[model samples]
Target: MLMAMRYHIWTEGCQMNEADSAKLAAGLARLGYQEASRPEEADLAVVNTCVVRQKAEDRAISYLGYLRHLKEKRNPGMRIAVMGCLVGPRVDDLKARLPFVDIWARPQDFDAILRELVPENDLGGEFWPETFPEPRGPTAYVPVVHGCNKFCTYCIVPYRRGRERSRTIEDVRREVAYLCGRGVREVTLLGQTVEAYGKDLPDRPDLGDLMAAIHDTPGLLRIRFLTSYPKDMTEHIVRSVAELPKVCEYFNIPVQAGDNEVLARMRRGYTVEEYLEWVDRIRELVPGCAITTDVIVGFCGETEKQFQHTLDLLERVRFDKVHVAAYSPRPGTIAWRQMEDDVPHHEKMRRLHAVEAVQERIASEINAALVGTVQEVLVEGERGGKPFGRTRSNKLVHFPGEARPGELVQVRVTRASAWSLQGELVAAAAPAGS
Candidate 1:
């Protein structure tokens, strides 16, 4: 018997990238390649890179340099591949810079890489199969839409990932059904701007239509979609969340900045008042919805009053979670090409920490209010010797229980903190979608 060829993939960035890695891993498996524990042990090593921020790009470049050294010194026969945003649409410059790379693949383009590995075997059109060989976990991410059309000045996603493209409703439905059959209880539909799903499709179906199609999958207990654009989050989608029992009441809408001037500078396409109206509608339709947002501090030419406006918005919204980042100008973005990155690094960090401090206090207070309330938690797995999971509202809860993974349990909130909740097991609920 011959030993199987081993491969390793190192992934970075968002959930969409994670899904892409899973697809690549499955493709490698189909080609008779076994997974290696580390890059050093593999005959093929792939770095699925992210270049959204300057730091991420630098880290990826440094890792590639390490791999080059490893191939030269230890594993002379090892084949190297670089995929994702780092490679982008054109790789001539990258090819000249990183000559050691055997394959360079664009984001979500798995067929190109797989074909390069095994030239003779045709992958029969689509590289992503309807079902994977094994269940990944209790949770899975499925990309319903790819790329972005919105070119927010500070974002490189549009340039790297390209224009918006949505998978058909039936196609997405099939994937979700297959995942549920293999024991995935929770699915998060993904996109660069998730709310823009189905706009490009022939039937012109929206995300609400997509969610409605997938809501009744046999084993699926919860459905979620994320990184929504405020301008694209239609009333239909909000109503869908209110109507669908399986759909979790959670929204991850990124309000990049709070001030109108900063938002316009970023080309976000919506005003603070407009964003607030959308939030109000969501709250009115779906009470107790866990609203989370992303914020970037110290954009091009942001002043103290502008920064204070963001703080005011944070206080006003009191989001369940706030993802804060200091702006790092990426080359090829509009901000990099046209605007001066006038904010000093120290000032950026200061604003970032300030936003964090405000959010931390708000979150602590909001979670504290959940004490004594019963939350339905789908036990993901054991953490710190206790069963841990998230509520339908996406709040993390750790509780002492005999509940196993994939089992939904009713938990009584005992204590709450800024990040998570402490709970006591109340009862074991029936199987999800029962």
Candidate 2:
């Protein structure tokens, strides 16, 4: 009998891609393949890629080229596949461009790729699995929806990943239950625009309804979702965070830009006033909610005043964290066709740093407030002799302790830095579920 081959998967891009990669891994395990610790140690390698920016796409293609040497040296039957947004439009072209790549599947056909890995079933019927698997370990990504309906001018997601499609409420519940049974304590729901979940489905069970259902789930300690579009954020979702026991108060809403005119140019759908109002409402409902955002600096035609508006908005909103990026033109997007990437590279860097500096000061101030509080934290695990966990508000905490992983504990924060809290564990405690 042939020995089962160990496989390695390398992922790039957003939370959705990470979830897709996890599902693919579970499918591979069902087909008798175990995970390898590194790329070179495996008989198979899969690159689940992202195409959000021009540089990211270039990096994925270049990385695929680099792996050609491994292909040449590995077993004659070693398999390599490329999936996610990178394989969307140019599947045939990518195959033609790099014939060394053995499989070209999109995000939808992840299960099919796993079946193709089986030597005797290269053409298995409907090989794609329908249900999310019970993960082999503690952490997992659960994608409640896929694709985006919004056609942001600079974004390639609408063109490449296509329109939004939500999984059924029943399906999501079953998936979460399966993961929980496998000792999974935490799950982050994934999507291109997660707030837009359930739009296409009949009866339209929106994000709030989904969260309520998940909150009722037994044995689930932590629940979170990501990449919410500002326009689709409903008041109900805000209330869900306030009311749901398991829902983390941390919201990852991406404001993108702060000026109305710049936002109009970017087609963000919400103005700076509207964004701030929503933030205000969130703060009102969840006082200690740790709000974070994504900011795009130097969008097309952004004037100095508009750039200052972004900084001003940051100062006002005081986001706990900000993911700052300089705009890069992507092929086949509205901005690429209509606007100019005239913002000089130096200017983009300057604006990005300016935004970062303001964010650093705000983060430091906000974190400093937690210095003497004992926060209830779900003990995640240990790294480098220190145990780490996440607070109810999703703040990361680590300290010296003898607590077992997955136990909830109260940690008195001895020190607070701009980004995270450092402390010592007071005593291991139980969350409501525990």
Candidate 3:
């Protein structure tokens, strides 16, 4: 009897990359490949990487080094493939640098690796598998949009992933329906700038239209999208969230910096006043909605006063959550080529922690308000042997209950924390909009 060919995929970065990895794994499964727990045990070892931050890039490089050593010392015939942003647009440099890597597939280009691995087979036609592999869990990520057009000065996505492209509503709907059949109850429509979806299509339907198109998916209990651009977040999108029962009342709008000067330097294309107006509009339209944001601290030439502006903005907004990152220049980004990274390393850390501290207090206060309320949670899975899930507002809830994954349950908040809610199971509930 022949031994089964095993493959392993090690992934790093955003939810988009996670979705990409799942798609690739599904493709590999269709080609008669079983998953190996570790790289050493696999016939093919793939590394899906990210270069969004210097730290992320360092981690990818370090892992590749390990794989290189492993191949030379132990697994001489092990095939290694490198994918994602770290591979970039042109792989000649990366190919030369990581010569041991048998395949150098770009981000979301799974066919490149698949073709290389199964050269004897005629694996053509639609790259996506009709049925995803087993153990897909109750929740899954679906990438509606690919790449990005917004070339923010500090961002390397456009350079790495190329221009924006969107999947048609019909195409997205098919995937959602297929995922529903596979026992996925919740789906998060993903993109670098999720709200910018449909701009490139001929009909230009927009994100609101896309959500409405899939609102009636038979088994899908919830819908969500993320990483929105402030300018592209239209009233239509907010209203869609209010009108669509399945769509979660959560928005992840990234305001790279709070000060206008920093915003211009980052080429974010919006002012602090403009961003505030959008936030106010969202709150006015969607009651009890959870608004999250991303902030980059210590961008090129960011002064103490400018950093104080960011602190003030956080205090003013009192966002439900804040994702803060310290600035690290990427080689091809406009910021790296044109400006100086004048902020010291310690100063960057100080600013990053300052934002975290303020946001922590705000999140604690916001969650504290929900202590006596009951949140309808789609029980995703368990943590520490207790069922855990997320509310429509995207707040994590941990409850004491005998609930299986994919079941909807009402959880009465018993305790509140900054990151999650501790709850007691009140009753099982029907899917939302049922």
Candidate 4:
């Protein structure tokens, strides 16, 4: 028998963390646990941490400090468990810095954390039956694989989450079908290196085959995937997205640096020229596809010439959007061990702004072209007398409409900004309400 317990989960980091939290919530629910409306009233609290960057770790620690205060003053008996990228054996700071944490579960300690924190008689080996959180909305993240095989010099994911391991194509199809059956219209296949999905599995079905399996899932209106590696992005995968009816025309392929020298230093196999060729191919294959990327400025010893190359790439590529970050050090990454953190803080900021400025200009120009066109948007929510959603291309569109989250509506793009589109509903659609 399970005791009456309520848990509050504090999630941090990427979509992988969010999916893990959803799975954790589902397990807790199966163990007869309810969610606490407030952290102070919870019997158990889980801090899902992220150590991708120094700032993420600091943010988690800050929240844990406050949670510790809550536990000491109002809920001393409450069980506190910390899990995710920041709690693994490699990390050495949690014990001294935040001693109030009752249990520390490493990145792979999913069942152990739940069993100890939930106080159950037996959690039997089978944890996959009621394996997910209830699908409450239109969009859900289904992680196709866990961890990264690529140990990019500045990256901490491989160190934190371990090597690449993929869910079988059958398992992935089952989960996607489950989500769609419960009113989830859109599913983004998640992974640290999602492009590397299905490599470890015995049958060796690639991402295209996995998508083909899920493309016909009933009630599924749209599908997407993220964080693709440039080198592994095959012509077949691009063809799959282009030809598949349900797949959205959005590709989030990251090219960390534009200079070949910098890319080589970072251990990214593909050169800048090769990356540009891939971009050209995606655009040629999937016209009007929303191609987005990530850029890290001032990595270790990157020079002014390399930074200019990045700007030139931005000008040449003109991506739909760019996720820009200034370089930051981590404890065990190759950059930390082998290279100098030679880029000064202020210089890093300057390079970051320069990169952003280039992308912002490119995005604004690209978005500006969307004016006077009709876009099919998935209504996500409303604010200020307008509903907001994303186009199949993943551009955020804010429009005047009566539709709520989950409905697909047509909107005429009346205005455009660098980051979002402003429009008015052109067709009425029934909302897929909660």
At residue 282, what lDDT does model 2 achieve?
89
lDDT of each: 0.90, 0.83, 0.90, 0.86
lDDT of candidate 2 over 312-421, digit per residue (tens): 99988988899999999887889999999989999999999999999999999988999999998887778899988788777888899787666778999999878789
**Considering only N, C-alpha and C atoms within 3 Å, which residue pairs clash in candidate 1?**
none
**Prediction-by-prediction clash tally:** 0, 0, 0, 0
TM-score of 3: 0.97
**What is the per-residue lDDT of model 4 for residues 1-434, given as tens digits with 9 covering 90 to 100?**
85688999999998889888888888888877899878887898999999887788899988898898988888889888898998766445767777788888777567867767544356544443447667757899999988898899999888778899999988888888888778888999988888889899888888888999998887778899997999889989999999998899999999989999999999999999999999999999999898899999999779999999999998889889999888898888899999999989999999999888888888899999999999999887778878898999999999875887788899999999999999988995444632
Error of 2 at 236 (Å): 1.4
Error of 3 at 271 (Å): 0.4
Q: Candidate 3's residue-wise lDDT over 67-139, tens digit each?
A: 9999999999999998999987668988888899999888888888887876654555435446443436888
Residue-by-residue lDDT tens digits, candidate 1, 275-381: 99999999999999999999999999999999999999999889999999899998899999999999999999999999999999999999999999999999899
- The C-alpha RMSD in Å for every predicted model, in order, reads 1.8, 2.1, 1.9, 2.3
Off by over 4 Å in 1: 122-134, 432-434
Q: What is the Cα-based lDDT of residue 430 in candidate 4?
A: 46
lDDT rank, highest first? 1, 3, 4, 2
Model 4: lowest-lDDT 10 consecutive positions: 120-129
- Cand. 4 TM to true fold: 0.95
